[model samples]
Target: MKENENKNEIVEIDDVDREIINLFNEDGRMSYRKIAKLLNVSIGTVHNRMEKLTKNGVIQKFTPVIDHSKLGYNLTTIIGVRVKGGVLENWEDRTAYHKNVLCMYDVTGEFDAILVARFKDTSELDQFIKSLLREPDVQRTYTQTVLNIVKEDLSSSKML
Candidate 1:
């Protein structure tokens, strides 16, 4: 059900679809009826468009953006890592349970994997680091503290 060509396919999007996407990108929880009212379209049209959009994979899942610092997680870092001994296997399964993990990427540069994580303080970060080191295949790890987040969001991201 997934196609590699669909990964970055450029398609002509109607203004209505673009508006719907833009509005939802701004606020995912906005009601369809409210959107319909705003767009001056029928509720059924909104529903049908949304269904088609999602089924065709034009829209992914909607989720809330959280402020981890307000939740007592102030420390954020990008930990460049090297994995050996076929360690990338089942890596997602191993790390999915970690609450502090923000995102992970397999890359081809100086690092085999890049882990973006957050913690409440130095202790928590140290503990997570120690845990990563325990993986025998993990040869080395370098962490850089995130001093600031200028802009991060779907609005800033490139869309198809």
Candidate 2:
């Protein structure tokens, strides 16, 4: 966050920083030299900006975007959990560690927590749901299968 090497301190993002983030959002593998050329800035500038971004926790990690369907994880499900009183966060924290779980969120409406997970088929999903029901403080779950993923982008660049 702090351009001064102290990561704990927050720093304001300028246009150059946004441009650098947008470039990385488009292609994470884009070299600093390339980014520098594109932005008409020095390679050191790009490198320093990226370093600050990482230290500040803006860019968590550079990872490949895997196609879940190609990996045989064709079934995408959203499981809404209604947890017992005072155990919502505990249930969410526990369930988030499951390998199949992609993400979890404490939410409003009828459910206390929502889990986004992937499975190979309905049988796998059924097993996961049953296992969740067996956990203490898990009141009930409503599972919805995702028919299609119209658009999914993990990048925060769009927020800029």
Compare the candidates by TM-score and give the number of the best one: 2
Query: What ranges in model 1 sit over 4 Å off?
Result: 1-12, 154-160
lDDT of each: 0.82, 0.88
The CA-based lDDT of model 2 is what? 0.88
Candidate 2: worst 10 consecutive residues by lDDT?
1-10
Clashing pairs in 1: none
lDDT, residue 29, model 2: 88
Which candidate number has the best lDDT?
2
- Give the alpha carbon lDDT tens digit for every residue of 17-75 in model 1: 87788778778899999999999999898899888788677876777888888999999
